[model samples]
Target: MTRCLRRIAPLALALCHLAAATPAAAQESAAAEALFDRGLADMEAGKYETGCASIAESHRIEPKPGALFTLAICESRWGRVASAFTRFGDYLALYEQMTPDQKSRQGERAKVARKERDRLGPLVPELSLSLPPGAPAGTVVKRDGRAVDGALLGKGVPVEPGEHVVSTQAPGGPVWETRIQLAEGEKKRVALQVNGASTAAPSGGISGRRTAAFVAGGVGVAGLVLGGVTGALTLGKKSVVEEHCGSAIGVSDETACDQTGIDAAESASTTGLVSTIGFGLGLAGLGAAAVLFLTEPKQGEEAAAATSRRIRARVLAAGPDGVVIGARGAW
Candidate 1:
């Protein structure tokens, strides 16, 4: 009986130790979950700042990032320029995991983007127009839809007869100068850009996403290398522990000496594997960037070709509203 008791004592004690560790781990996880939920709620409400904080805290525990994306969109709507930049991070994280199948679809998306990017250039206001008889009243000069303060009646303001530009500054956007012309009547139309690298002429294929993938993938690769080193060192520690303690280390002894070595090895191995994945992701990102760079111009050319919309009118009139009088022409 004494011998049995002695043998069982260590096992029971170890069990108790393990049991004590469980609640702490559970509590930590619960806290992380709570934070994540709160972040999700904030994101839905468009409270980006609060959402970001909650998500970041939760991420430390769970290491996920849906909340970060929600926050970025909210910030963009509010015109929070700085936060918009932070939102880009969420896209970068997700992109690192894209497979070849996903990347293959990028070309199609790039084509559409390029088409829109160069849809129009700065409006060149037409000069020396002969005003027709009975030109309609309330003919407001517009460049893209706002009031062009102090734009000259005789001075140049870009137009294409269907777009509007009512700006005080230079119509600073691709299609910044509109073609919306007023016939002394009125028209309503609105178009949205998919917000590429912002400039009057968008850098069609930037998508801003490729750059992020490149950076994150690089970081992941570096982490892999670091993890590999750590794993190697931990293995050495494991050797030392086994040499000194033998199999007894994991038996009823539970001296904690071998525990350190085991923990080190586990941590190193886990991180090392993760690091390799990161490294691979990094390389892929860089490669993707190269691909995107080469692809954009091709896409842009296609888009331009498509937009070569020619006009073929049998007969027409000439007026401020475009041949409002008697004329015949082709576009």
Candidate 2:
């Protein structure tokens, strides 16, 4: 009896601890569900802006495939076809992990996503990039300031219809750059030249430090935007909680608070954290941008560099007896 009690006691204690944790988890789940319901209602009422915001908040509170699917649908309905397409791709990635029954349940959504992708596929613009023959072995290419993956080089890459800048650089080579505009269903090929060793360098070129500062600044700006959106969501959730479980409602302590209130408060805290992060990033970005700009050379050097490349033409004529050389310069 003593031995049996020792083993059973541990099991009983473990079960008790598990049971104690259940209420908190259940409460959080309930809160997320309430937010989801509100979002759904708003979406149905065609208050899309608020509805989408609420939906995004709900997803943040508790990421789920269903919420993602709904968000995709909302984007599609709003005529954000490109955004919807991206969301649909994300949904499909998540859906692949479901069981057979779960997959069946989401079959209709999958069909809709496929249909949309196919319909939009033909209308999407693409860019085909290539480097000139005998380019430096390690030349790197970028589109819109982002590096192209090695596998994507010399292949057709899908892009939104718009103007795009393509640039390339290699060790011991000058930067080659060009800009192109693409319309829907258009495919344009761009070739990059690897400047020979003898080519003149651009005056006061952008330094590595300046480039790093610029990238950091961009990231910081993104973080700030995230913080702002999350902060607003936190405020919204807090208001909801206060309405349902304020001090006037005899819920002085969080433990005694309504489940909805608890969930909202938690969400608010999360968003506040995100907001703090965003502001931090934004400040950092501005600071880096300033410092980099200050340390980099002025516009006069760049103008001079531009002027150096503006030569007119050189003509060489070989006649029956002799050769004559003539040159024209931009006065």
Candidate 3:
């Protein structure tokens, strides 16, 4: 009795395991069938994207011949001719491996798959890529973000008709990339080259600070000349006032002044005010020019220098009384 029980123990355990697995397998099949039905309904309603997604998931869960054929049809109708062609080929291959009874049941679908595959063969687009002579070894070429087989280079490989991005990069080199659009049955050849050198910065011109410095210096010189000319005229007018009014050189008593003396004094005041304004402008302009020239940026430090130093100088107001020079800066 013990010997008999030992012999039967393994068999019973196997049966128990099989019975336990059966429900899970049945649930998966049921889920796959539901997804397949939903996919068909969605496709009928002209929702190809979602339909294809559901069908693909169904096929992944249970790779049934009917589901594969239906998925191929959905892909074809959705404009993915290459994917449909590949799926149809897969279905036909699966049909070849089916038992006689299975083959009999799938015979008509197999015929349709073969016919569609053949029809799409000539309509699919092809892409051929190549590298220039003397291209570096280990240069990787990619299409649509996936690496392309080196053996496929220079060979016309079938692809789906649409836009594709082709890029090539060598080790430690800049990536060279291009975009290509292909129509049905069109064949295109692309030659890729690695760009080893980086783009260079722009070449020489006058720096902004130097230009501003030159302008300020010019303004300063002009102001100094105006101040000198006006100063001399003021001295001549004061002499006239002193001579006509019998006033001392530095005296300000204008009560005894004649018309000539009053006019001379008024002219002197005008020239004197102008002199003061010109001198003020000259000093401010020269100081600004000096600061700008001294704080000019060195090579490769232009941006840092700009942020570090900011100086502005201008004339605020000028009139008979006096002139105002305004200067603001940060170091």
Candidate 4:
């Protein structure tokens, strides 16, 4: 019992001191005053939206109806009547709790303040939030370094300066986001961008490449034609020479004609051999060019060059195209 008492006694004493040290109501009022001023400052700076939020918070903590009315009025030029009506009810309740002297002072203050503040009540065009395209679905958009959830798409209402965030989500779609800063009375369109796959390939790409291959094959055929022409010419020249040589030998002894026939026949045979080789080689070269054009840039080239290059994600379902490849990476 003594041991338990010792532990409990210190805790009790600490609790008493803590309560004595903290004046909850006074502290709350002080915080409300500070928040109220912050909202006013934001308003002056053209951050009406942020000002509205701050002022609303101040009134919530201290039940300051005048402050709440001023907030509702200035936040959207008094357009938030629903909020003002709600706050007014609470304000009157708190007003009833005040002493006679407090009530008198507030009434006098209200007369002067309301006259002036009335004109400024209701900030025109309430502020709202939004996101952009290409953002991942279900990802939050950031503004001023803070994340905002459920930012709607399209242009949002003007915001107070400093920063704001828009949160976004799209089922089976790219997440979208956008950040914006607004000054008082500033209006602007916020665009939302989303990212996703392209549905169709570009035109005349593979087709053009295939056309080139056909053109190359045609050149190869031309080479064959050249070979045939040369071969035919050689054969024709040699046949003519043989006929002349045979005729000359039978009719008369002519050494010069015989020598001419022999030379012509040998020249034609050499021509045929050269033409055949050239035709074969040209066809091979054309084949090689076609292969190079049809193939993708090699993996080696991809690995070596990684600076701001275009990247694609593809899933192959079957056969040679259906392989999963991974890269070694460092972050």
Candidate 5:
């Protein structure tokens, strides 16, 4: 009696669990049927977008050959040739797995699906992709944001008619992207290339920034020396003018000067102008040198080179009248 009761208790629990799940299953079936009906109504009203969406949802809730076939039809009328073709193939495949009685019921729909799939086979566009010679190994290719199989490379593969984005990336290389458009029944091939070489300076070497800094420093020192020499010459000329023309350093009495005094004053003015220009060049060069040295990149020669390329310094000696020196950069 005790053994019998144990067996019976297990059976009772199983039955109770089945009963509890029955209502949920029924609810799902009801919802799927409702969606299917609504989708059909929408498609008949020429609203393919909403109709297809509803039907797809209904198929997701409860997969059925009828719903899939209807969805294929909706997609066909909506001009999604690739989608319609794939869905029709799916319906035919599903029909093959149905039981004898089920197959009998779905035979007509299966025939239509096969016919449609065959009709679209020639209308679908094909795209072939190939890598350029010397392409790096482990390169990844994608079409429309989906990964493409390596085996499909250089082979014509079916694609939907319209615009598509193709992208490729190799190890340690920059991503390459291109857009392509195809019409129905069109076939096209594309050759992809990757720019993988680094543009940075080589390792274990002086960076561009350092080189620029040295150049700027040298210019600064030279400018300073020129300014000093020119300034001394100006001072000597000024002394001569003062002695001959009764002109002090800041005060010039031209009426009290003869030709020699006037000549001395002119020489002093020209030398003073050269001195001023030299001083300006020296100051600007030194400032640029300081900034470059302080902001030099520490990553590597390559990074420094990239950073230095953005910075530019120009110095022009405009025939001793004035000197122009300035630096421009991104940051």
Candidate 6:
């Protein structure tokens, strides 16, 4: 409890001693004043994010020395030392404009703000980004989605400690992007090297091999269905021929098969042949589909290079005798 009290004491003292305004609040709109009061209340309630947002909004609506001071303190509480330091610098600028009474009222707060800024100096994350020599004119650099001024290039600038994205691009040139994670007080220097590598974007929705595999699989399924139908037809015709030829051809050993029986036998033979071809083609297609689906290359140049090694498959009639299926190549 004592340690906790010690931690809370400084913030409580700062809140109590600091005047929220350097000048009277008379010039601000009722909405701004209300928001400012609400922000302060929120901070006192330990709703730091809401408080900071409200305070920032109030400042945006009406620029007040008090809101600036509050925003700096809120940022400090939020552990964004870089932003707090900058905001404190902004608050100090109003020092010169205060009346004697205002100065007296704000002196303690100014001292506290200065000390806080000094304390946060070494705990802030900084980044130094430099482009390669002779980087094209009109090149732009961005840090965490915000554009960095060209003038600040090659110089260390304070940033919030966490993950950040650094990107640079020139008109008609390649874009370079990298992510960096920083700890408290960490400093990093990055030198960007541009290259011809293109940014990877998904193409044609699905990969070529995968799409082909799906198509081949579909065809294979259709062929299998046709094969099944032809097989049933062959069986039905054979059954019909047997029914017609029943005991007549074998009893006398010389009774010629009737036209209906002969025709049925021929039809069955044709349908059986069709069924065999369909089965062979269907099996070949399904094998090809399995290979294609399983062999889809992963992302990058290696994938592009592997296209040549993909499986190739074919279905062909073996001869007048039967159908043949074949495949070759690296999967």
The candidate maximizing TM-score is 3
TM-score of each: 0.26, 0.43, 0.57, 0.32, 0.56, 0.49
The residue-by-residue lDDT of candidate 5 on 53-89, one tens digit each, is: 9999999999988999999999888877888989999
Model 1, residue 275: C-alpha shift (Å)? 2.5
Kindly list the per-residue Cα lDDT of model 3 for residues 1-331, writing each as its tens digit. Answer: 9999999999999999999999999999999999999999998888999999999999999988899999999989988888999999999888889899989987589888888999998889999998775467788899999999999999998898999999988878888899999999899998776676322123345666778888988888888889899999999998887777744534466556777888988998888888887876776677778877776766676667568867666566765455566667798
Q: How accurate locally is residue 79 in candidate 5, as Cα lDDT from 0 to 100? A: 76
Off by over 4 Å in 4: 9-36, 44-203, 207-216, 232-245, 248-263, 273-331
Rank list by lDDT: 3, 5, 6, 2, 4, 1
* Regions of model 3 farther than 4 Å from truth: 197-331
The model with the greater lDDT, 1 or 4, is 4
lDDT of 4 by residue, 229-279 (tens): 787887887776767675556856443456668778778778777677556
Alpha-carbon lDDT, every model:
0.47, 0.72, 0.83, 0.56, 0.82, 0.78
- Answer with 1 or 3, whichever has the higher TM-score: 3
Could you give the C-alpha RMSD of every candidate to the true structure, in order shown? 42.2, 37.5, 13.3, 14.1, 11.4, 17.6
For candidate 2, the 10 contiguous residues with the lowest summed lDDT are 311-320
Error of 3 at 275 (Å): 58
Q: Give model 5's TM-score versus the native structure.
A: 0.56
- Give, for candidate 1, the lowest lDDT window spanning 10 residues: 318-327
Prediction 6 global C-alpha lDDT: 0.78
Best-matching candidate per lDDT: 3
Tell me the lDDT of model 5 at 220: 81
Model 5 segments more than 4 A misplaced: 197-331
Give the 10-residue window scoring lowest on summed lDDT in candidate 6. 196-205
Per-residue lDDT of 62 in model 5: 95
